[model samples]
Target: MEMRAPEEIEIGQDITPPILPLAFTLSDSSLHSHCSSCFHPLNPKIPKPKPNNSHNPVPIPCNSHCNSSLLYCSHHCRHADADLHVSSGECHLFLQSDTSTWPSELSQLRLALRLFLCFQKLGFLSPEFLVSGRIGGLMSNREKFDIPGRIREGGRIMCLARRMRDGRFGNVVGESATDEMVLCLVLTNAVEVQVSEGRTIGVAVYGPGFSWFNHSCSPNASYRFSLTGFIGEPGSLEPGFRVTPCGEEGTFKAWNGDEDKLTNGSCKYGPKVMIRSIKSIKKGEEVCVAYADLLHPKMLRQSELWEKYRFVCCCDRCNSSPLTYVDRILQQNAANHSTCLDLDHSLCVEEAYRELTDCLDQAITEYMSSGNPESCCEMLEKMLIESSKTEQSQPLEPSPSNFKLHPLHHLSLNSYMTLASAYRIRALDSDSDKDNQLEAFELSRAGAAYSLLLAGATHHLFSSDSSLIAPAAHFWISAGESLMGLVKSSKWSSIIKKSSGFNLSSLLTQRSGKCLLLTELELGFVLRDGFDVVCKGFLACISRISPKVWPFLVHGLPYLKDINDPLDFSWLGMTARHEAQALIGGCECEGVAYIEEETIWKGLVLFALHCLLYGGYLTSVCYGPHCYLIGHVRNLLYGGEGSSLSENVENIC
Candidate 1:
């Protein structure tokens, strides 16, 4: 079965009405901070002794029976979900005498339990659905999986889930393989509900209208979650209008919108899903969404899809011969020439690449888990320096120093994001003593630079492929925020004061209103212009300003010192012609005409604002205006000369 557009769908238009899930569960990590029923952020601050990365959630009324059982943001949410929660037998997992001993991986088990109870209530266990391995309009993929570890885990969960009536409060859940089937279905169909970057709160499984949509590496549609009450978003498309399920002849039975009997069920505050077109879709054409991230290389994507969904992706992007330029850039060894990666790489290049990637990945992972910023900074910078080596005199033997990852390499992109975050954390951890103040200042500066470079590097790739717009939106907004933070730093106050002659008060005042409505900007970016047009204008404008400000952003950062131009990646070329590829020829700050510190910051202000504007435009397309992400971007771009970046910054973090 697949989903097809019922009418012509324009880019950025909603493809489906907000549809409720058949079952869902808040991830164990998210249970304490987000409402169990609705996934709403909770209330009251529980200040930690140490500085923390995530926002302090507001607390709300929690579970009464057992504090560890579930959390709800409001009485209505609890009221809405109580019956389903109680009957699903999940409440027993936390109410038992061994409540404190519940497995940390209880989320999947709980989700599967909910599916079992809900389907049972809907009388959806008929042999007809089971024979096809698709129950409740969702694929079980039961036959696709044969791994012993998974089979053992599923058996264990089935045993533990036996609850009341059958395995009730005093007893423990499997009956005639229902639990096994539902667990497999959960594994096959659940979509992670990610509300923010690097944050996935839970998982949800929707019905036919959503589940039938196929996978595409180059997808035309994208989906976002709306975690709201029984009443979904105001002005949301009503059901049965935008899309229709295209069930294959004699292969899968189409749902006759046959879920009427299940309509009276509860969980009023469950998350709703709506799919939108990232690319235009014509009536009767199939609409697809990416089942996995698109940025992964073809091999990684195929491996992941096979492991999880049991199918190899033959999407056009994955099947392209000679490989697409974007794919080439993502996996290329930049130290090598613009040569094809045939059956083999030079012994030196291949080994160096493997060692460096492993080393870089390990450093990044350690930093995230341990928050050891200084060590992370040291290790990543060393790897970056190693990766950028350009010497034909290089030894034929394998060595870390000989390996290279271009700025646009996916791994390099990961390092940039980690470094940007690590530097900010290092700044946050520094003391206020005068000796450390300068260090903190540089740390902040480095963070902002990494963020900007990330945006620029990704923007360069985005100029080639408009489909990268989602990630492009995120990077640009992040860069804008970092720059805004830098400009407001006390370290810049004295310099900026002296450069009052370089005031952007006019821009701040004139564009404040227009910032909120992207259509009003001079570029009229996302709304009034095609992506190709915006890409050209953005790249041209950013390039002209990069030389003046890039050095200032990368100052004191060794990893970034050699990057003469962040937005123009032509500088990243083969080892033999490295000198010829040197456009700025080392840092441009020393060679370019002298500009005042104040003028440099003025340039930063202009740079940051345009990035935010461009990011905001891209975001409007990727996440429609009603999304919280769009609201956050609007607030970031709403500032004027007198406004503080902090005022709106908190909304995102």
Candidate 2:
């Protein structure tokens, strides 16, 4: 859909039209949580009163084949879909095993079986519904999966097809319609059902008309998933998909509330996908939806598209170079409506890092808890203004010159984390006004992005000094805490409304966990690197903090070997201490050397300690017990140094 020049739009504007899934299946993980017929969540439509909680009604199942496992929103919807997919004998295959334990890949197989059943129900295949261009198009790994070998493993599919061929479903014989073609169609055309930003609830196959929309990395359009309200009328007794009212508790829970509920005396909700515009589209432009996450780095975005969708992204954003200091300075000045007469792009890398580091140092000094809040805010603003210019900068190739500095560089990472922490502290400041909280939230949001980007995708950071680990871990923990704060803030409702139909809260909450895991993984490496002298106290403190981090450390140590570095300490062996130790090194026993270094077990303590400390810090705001726990850990880490840990905890609370 295209628009004229005067037609301007903003984020969250519905893109004129919406599309519905042609055939959908719940993910194995979500099957137990949602009804099998209408795909509505299995949770109750209205909250049961406290008095009736113990007498809550049980849901009716689909059929004997899905008695305990499959559920429906209503008997009508259950019966409506029963003749098509479930009763046709496909549902029995899923029922034989524990449905909840099914692996994710089985979704594709399930979708294939359902499509075949739907075709049989219609008595014939419709040409309009089939995708053209090629067989198994855009489905990666077709060479391995889409084989004549399909028939070798066709016993179950053949059996199911035979059962569904009971004179009513097109009278199709066993050899009449092969399973390979149906499997190919499902594999090539299945669209992921995204329930929230960066999260998929299930996979669905759409009519060819719906699948024809092209993909874009910087898509002007976006989509959201919901349930169709009812069949035709509000109180009509017609059988259709049912939707539970969306509540205010979560972004997706409640509905618009304008529709009548008792229509048809049945609750019907079917899966619906609505496409909306994030930006205005000009006349003659194509409508697009992002097939992959836009938040991922360009290389990842392009690589996944190439591998999965068989295309390369030459999107403007991908083709463009990262913003340099000069580019940013000019943009910022232009946004401020300030003069840019002295613009210069000749800044070298060393000079750039030096300036950024100096700006960060000054900001850190002013960011102290002892400083005035106003002064600290000003300093933080300046620090962010300078450092964020580098936040998205990446080189085509890493070299020792200006291109070498990634966002994860010590100077940039520290600056971003410091600014983010300061903003969060101000946002939660007891004496601060609402305006301060708003501004703090904005800064926190941006800072958290940079922080997360640095830790996770900045692969270059993995080769840097071991000393950088502690600060990086601290930064990631701060990012997670700030995200949790946003999740709990009142501002979230408005944020959701303006979020281009994406679930901002869910995205942030998911990212918070990712940040924590990244922190744990990084600290695992740190503990392994500094096993003996440097990590002893850290390890001991952690064992008391939480014992859970130890297992992760034990499993994650081998991957943390800094394989990108030429001087990796682990595989290359640390410097020898004594002649006797070297001389008596090892007598080979079953292909193992008896030579000993510091016990790897000690590193487990250090890893667990930091994980506990960081985990506690992230939860300190609402979990008062964790507040005390983090406070103790902070005091343990810096007993006589200062009140940094306590101040951080206080700010978070």
Judged by TM-score, which candidate is best? 1
lDDT for every model?
A: 0.67, 0.41
Tens digit of lDDT per residue, candidate 2, span 124-169? 3444223332221122223444344543244345344445444333
Worst 10 residues of 1 by lDDT: 576-585
lDDT (tens digit, per residue) of candidate 1 on 545-625: 678888888776776887777776665442211121212112111122226776676667767766877787777777776
Clashes of each: 12, 18
**By summed lDDT, which 10 consecutive residues of candidate 2 come out lowest?**
582-591
Q: Please give the lDDT score for candidate 2.
A: 0.41
Which candidate number would show the highest lDDT if scored against the true structure? 1
Give the Å shift of residue 649 in candidate 1: 21
